[model samples]
Target chain A: MAALCGHGAPIALLSPAYNEAVTIVQSVRSLLSLQYPAFEVIVINDGSKDATLDTLIEAFELKPVSRAYDLAVPCNEIRGVYASPRLPRLVVIDKVNGGKADALNAGINISRAPVLCSMDADSLLEPDSLLRAVRPFVEDPERVIAVGGTVRLANGCRVRDGRVVEIGLGRHPLALFQTVEYLRAFLMARLAWSRMGALTIISGAFGLFRREAVVRAGGYTRGTVGEDMELVVKLHRQMRREKRDYRIAYVPEPVCWTEAPESWRVLGRQRSRWHRGSLETFFRHWAMFLNPRYGRVGLIGFLNIFIVDVLGPVIEVLGYILIPVLWLLGILSVEYLLAFLALSFTFGITISVCSLALEEIQLRRYPKARDLALLTLAAIFENFGYRQINNLWRIRGLWQYLRGSESWGVMTRKGFRAG
Target chain B: MTGGLLGGLWTASLLMAASSVLFMTGLVIARLISEAGRARRRARREALVADMMSAMDGEADAARLKSEVREPRLVARALLELSTLIRGRELAAVTAALTQAGAEPALLRLMRSRNGEDQIAACEALGLFPSDKAAAALKTRLKRRTSMRVRIAAARALLQMGETPDLNDLLAAFDIGEVHAPLELSAILDEIARRATEAYLERLKSSRDAPALRAMMVGVLGRLGRYEALPVLLGAASDPEPSVRAAALSALGALGHPDAEPIIAAALDDPVPEVRAEACDAAGRTALAALAPRLAERLDDDEWLVRFRAASALLRLGEAGRETLDAAAGRASPRAMRTAQMVLAEAAA
Candidate 1:
């Protein structure tokens, strides 16, 4: 066959970091090792109280540079800009504490590439991920505004010099359960949704976008907790309103690896924040809910997010509490209860196992049969208690959302085990 | 009646749970078997590739090499590996050997298969063989298949074959109304620009094409730096559509042709701000000393991008332009002054 094109288009990779000193250097190293020919790495140090900036400066020999940036997108004030003489492609922006969305906007302002990728500071990208993720942009430059790839859990993986050296199931049960959950969300639901041309969420861990489209959509909104999802929805709304053809794609390959919360406390905070963000985004774009003007995005995608994602948890939590009471009051039959439990647990396990199987069929990161077996066990185990607890967390998040709480709780991380 | 209904539900649930468990077990086993099979196949292919390489170095008989790697899949894999590592006469020899082994027909059959996975794999394999037959099969697939994956594979295979598909055919395949990933289109266009510049130019001359299509082709021409197409591009610069004019101006900038300077300078007065922005960028790229004054005037363009590009163009004009920007930074309109200061700060860094 013909030789692949020598050089793909240039890309600007934006990673918004906050108090991530432990993983910042490693992440930068990984970005440096990407296989794409033309790209730049811009890390927005979002006023981290930790030594994130110091670590980056020391690792890359960063020196302050008086750079010029057009404030096309609104963002917080940047304290300073630094560039490494040693690694010319690496740029760091020291900005005030403006959350993830604001940091991304600041990076977008300074980015010069036609294509931009917004990613998390703690996520590690596969060497060929950019090359693969960039395929869609090269194929349909006119309509494809954004593309997202599957994000896998890195909690159990072996790392050496910022690369995944080996794949294994995490020792932590919570981490294992999260791994299975991620597989289901990314491999099955996302692929199906993208095929229908109604994919809504491009994980903030790693999403590639057309620079012009993002600017036209007014960049990431400041107040939304789900900036990533909100930006995608806004892009959909904007492009549709302008009567332009566009697509938001989801690539099934595992392009990004992130550390999942290993402890229950951290996991609870993360899930609650996620649920609250979903609630806010759902309410914010309520016009699209069942609105014919938005087409499938409104009718199918919006409804799915509402009924399945937002409301399903509430219904499940209520069932958990009310079912036992009904049984005691003789309003529910013992046989019916047994049947419901069997169906729910079995169906849940079946879906999770199928997702694992799908992963095994394509881009099998897990190397060992034992790892697959363990993941399957975790899928079954999650249905027994973990899933219920997650539902409870969503319920609590709904309560907080109703009460008008807007706080993003702190999340502690145990840094990757680097070689 | 309620008791019977409950019993039926319980039985159904019990059966479902059992079947699901069995299904999970079956999938696990199937995965294990598939993994083992893949490992074995990979090892065999690796060994065959090693032998093929040695043979190519004149250490073994070519006939023996072909016979040893007789399996169609193995032959395709070996050829793909060799294509990347060797070129010219060595590559021709490998291709000839693979063709004699019936690799082309085998791949063509696979390309026509109903299985999507098999079809994609065949497209990848066909990229190694640049024959008329391979190109025809790929083009047929491109026309016949509506599956985006199949179409992409076919297009990539045709590009690999070094076949210059008609620009119209490509545009038709990449319908504007249909959502296609930009990266894939860019790659195809880049390949066509690199290998089939003449065909692209021919297509660019057709006024009958859609504006979006013409715009894209013009963009490709610019990217290819086809200096010979300067006259056509200059004519396109005055097209009725603003997008076409903007694209043509961008191409002129990319081509960096000094002769286009007069035309580009005239575009500064275009009604559309986008066209003016491209004109300003082109001025910077060509860096005509005479355009520096004109570019300086544009620093006051109402559009922020136009002003930004104007200041950038002036900076590219060396000492004279820098002096102009300095004056603007000191006493021009607020927007112009801010733009000049920003450009100056960037230059200092």
Candidate 2:
């Protein structure tokens, strides 16, 4: 609806590109085709040694432009700014190599709109997703500070003209397992927290924010693997300190399709990095844990994170090793062992299945009956081996965090299928 | 030895897992069936609509097709969809068809439906049929304390019906103390400006107490290109609130009227950085060559954005402004020189 009228508030789509020469052109083209009346696409070329900047310049027919912007947030040096005379809404920024957080800050500083949509360069947003994601801000512009949309795996979906033409479950078992995992994480967990008014994290893949709010909160925190979650937590702390009433929303209808890691090594690295980021964000803001001053966000929100992420891995891994040894040594009874196995294994299968069922009943993104059945099987099969391997990865992440490992492991993607 | 309770618990857990699997399968099957049914209904509706359109063109029996369509809501939607594509005599023909099919009464009935979506759709559809009954029904719906969305829809319908609904009545529906004014309200204001600019200008004159609302109104007026509000906008440029002043300066910039040059020039020296930024933008938009020295002086401003805008504004000027920027590049402070050089490099490229 906002596409028809010029009255919609201006928004800036800020994407950080790093060595993504393969997908950069398609992603940028998709962004320019978003169904919004007033918006601009700001793609930050984050010092890629590859052909990211050159590919963009050649593809867009870009030329240097005299644009004025403030360094509202900290970022690296900018080599130059380029714009195309043909596509006026597109602007490219070439800056030195900084992490994703630094690149986002560079884009924020250069952005002129009051609202900003931060997304990854590899992700593809549905055409109407921006309008749907920005509805909360239009409705209550004062109180809503941020919003996140559902992130679906784009592994096996059909792509046409840089859009997901058909929704298909990825054939890879790893990708299928992640499809179920993401459904649980976004649909159940995020929605539950959002209803309590204590949503802590908006995924870095796709989130909308009030420019002034993010700028006042000191932009995205640099040198953190979990910059997205950290910035949201920092916003909560700042708003609570100032005694301001604000909301961090999660809208499930708007979908942003992203490529999930397919191989075991890459998946392990991703899981570990995610766990490390969670630990880093947790310890960094430990004072908010059970603190009354931050209200439900401190008491309920941090408690959930502390139990599920910070402590869940260590206990699960210990149970896996120690339980069998104890039973073999006659220190624990066989009945008790069977009970433990039933609770851990069967209960997990139950949760994953119900999550898949909920997705089918509600969203129906998986249209084919065969794909639905395959996903259902994946949900059940994941509990046996995949879930155990994931716990081990998270435990490794815990160890990495303890050892002060700050590396973002190399993540490789088989590029999307051409139209 | 452990009791049998542990054994029974394991058995129960296994049973629970199996049942949940079955439950998921059942739900999936039900959904598939429901989707199929929905597809069937959609196909039937499309066929019926096509038939009705042909009837309207006299290729088919109009009375028979109208009576054959059982779903009033479906028929009403079809007529409304057809209304957007035609004009004049065709629109009149569609209206006659809708009345002949008794769609107006059905729409009124839907307006009173309990479902919020039904009510909203009814309100929107009624906009196409401008009658006293539809207007009265929408006004009644607006008076009720409903959701903001429904109220906004009702108000929009009233406006579309060429009725000058009270601005205060709409404003009363929203909480006044909110920091950021709703964009939907701005959209409504834009709609009102199309038909009744005086109504918006009148509200602008009286809305000083609420700075956020005042700023929003100023923005709306500017976007609508209502040059008649130039006097009000110029006065607002010196308002007590910085946001209002910025909005006024921005509106003036958009207008680019020669009469507002003095105000724009004075705003370049405004106390607030944001106001000065807007003033710089206005200077560039108006292309006042005489303000080149003032613009050059702003190149040394402390704020990064101000300096950047100052340099940009200078480039918007002609040869004299370029000479001033070149001088700044040669002799100004490091910050000013850097900005000037960047702007000059870009212009050269």
DockQ of each: 0.30, 0.30
- Those runs of model 1 whose alpha carbons end farther than 4 Å from true positions after fitting are A1-9, A240-244, B1-8, B11-19, B61-67, B89-198, B207-216, B235-246, B262-276, B297-304
RMSD values for the candidates in order, in angstroms, are 4.0, 4.1
Best by TM-score: 1
Clashes, model 1: 21
lDDT string, candidate 1, B1-349, tens digits = 9888777777776776677667767767877888899899888787777766665664545576566544666666566667778987776666666566566888787777687767887887798788888888888888873677778788888877777777678767766553223445656777777777777677777766655555666776677887988988998899886767887898898899999987998999899877898899889888887988899899888766688889888888899999999999999988788889988997887
C-alpha DockQ for predicted model 1: 0.30
lDDT of 2 by residue, B1-349 (tens): 3467776777779897889778877876876787798798787678766765664575555565556445556655665677677666656656566666666788888877787767777787787678999899888888888766777788888887789787766676654565555557777877776677877677777754366567777776678776798988998888887767888888887888878989989989988877898888888887888899999989989876678788888888888888999999999998889889877876786
Q: Each model's interface RMSD (Å)?
A: 6.0, 5.3
Report the lDDT tens digits of candidate 1 across residue range A1-419.
00011236578999999998987887899899899888999999999999999999998999999776678899999999999778989999999988999999999998877689999888889899998897776555556789999998888788887888787778899999999999999999999998998998999999999887899999999866789999999999998889888888888874798889988988998888888888888898999999989989999999999997687997888887898899889898777778778877877887887788788777777887778888888988998889989988888888878988877788888877665
Query: What Cα-based lDDT does every candidate model obtain?
Result: 0.82, 0.83
Judged by whole-model lDDT over C-alpha atoms, candidate 1 comes out at: 0.82
